[model samples]
Target: MLSPEDVQKVATLARLKLSTEELQQVSRQLDGILDYVAVLNEVDVSNVEPMAHVADVANAFREDEVRASLPREESLSNAPKTDGKYFLVPQILETA
Candidate 1:
């Protein structure tokens, strides 16, 4: 069972602000979750094979191929702001 203090600690780590009532409720919920996990821990899996995924999944990625790209003028045509040679974006940093 999770104590209120334990819930508070977890909330603090997660940077969550919970009221007293919420803390109590979350404590009970966490306790229940832990209890369910404990029950699952008791299941026999010694004969089961370990696997990354339940389904037989395989990567279906195509091989990368070199290709010509769109011209610079055409590429910059969709930009909200550009200086003909480059995309013009807001200056985010200032020299100290």
Candidate 2:
């Protein structure tokens, strides 16, 4: 349980400006959330095993195979700008 003053302190740290009504509302909401978390903590799981995933899963791999690629000349021929073997771009750095 958090006091109203504690909620105010949290609001101040967050740089949030809340009215008196909003402060009260937020304080109640925060307390409710804390209470719900406390209930969750009361659950017994001593015999339960932790699992990495909820559903059964396995790696689906495909057979490795060689494939042909588009010709380099055809790939770069439509470029707005190119530097022979690669694409060219405007300078990113500013001159001093």
Candidate 3:
């Protein structure tokens, strides 16, 4: 069970301002949460192995293979604006 003072102290550490009513409300809520945790602590899981996931998972990647590249003119044909060899984009940053 968490006392009102304990709740108040936690609120202070978290930089929260609580009225008297709010402090009491939070204290009750904290006590209930602690009670639930205590119930969980009574469960026996000594035989269970720790698992990272509930379902089996595997990497699903396609085999890599080299392929012919698109010609520069064909690739740049649809660009709104481009240099002969590269895409021409608006400058968005300034250097000090």
Candidate 4:
């Protein structure tokens, strides 16, 4: 079982703000989670093969076909704000 101090340390590391009651509750819950992991660690996997994932799958990406893009005026038509030739967005970075 995790101690109160240990629970407090973990909460601090995780940036959590907990009351005394919540700390006690979390300590018990964390102990249960650790105990469950200990049980899993005891399972034998000597015959099992290591894998990237449990399932075998591959991505099927479509080929890119470069063609004509939307006209500047058409693309800017739906924008909430636009300058004559381009999209007008709020300045995020200041110029040096």
Off by over 4 Å in 1: 46-96
lDDT for model 4: 0.88
Better of 2 and 3 by TM-score: 3
lDDT of 3 by residue, 54-88 (tens): 77767768769987899999999999999878999
lDDT accuracy of residue 54 in candidate 1: 69
User: Model 2: per-residue lDDT, tens digit, 1-96?
Assistant: 788899999999999999999999999999998988888687898998988787766777888898888788888999999976988899999999
Best by TM-score: 1
Taking the tens digit of each residue's C-alpha lDDT, what string does model 1 give over 1-96? 777788899999999999999999888888888887898777899888878876776987887998899999999999999999899999889979
- Candidate 4 error regions (>4 Å): 44-96
User: In model 3, how large is the Cα lDDT of residue 13?
Assistant: 100
After superposition on all CA atoms, what RMSD does each candidate show versus the true structure? Answer: 7.4, 10.8, 11.9, 7.9
How do the residues 37-96 of candidate 4 rate in per-residue lDDT, one tens digit apiece?
898777899998878775656776887988899888898899998886888889999999
Inter-residue clash pairs, candidate 2: none
Runs of candidate 2 with Cα error greater than 4 angstroms are: 43-96
lDDT of all the models against the reference? Answer: 0.89, 0.90, 0.88, 0.88
* Residue 36 Cα positional deviation in candidate 3, in Å, after optimal superposition: 1.1
Model 4 lDDT, residue 79, Cα: 90
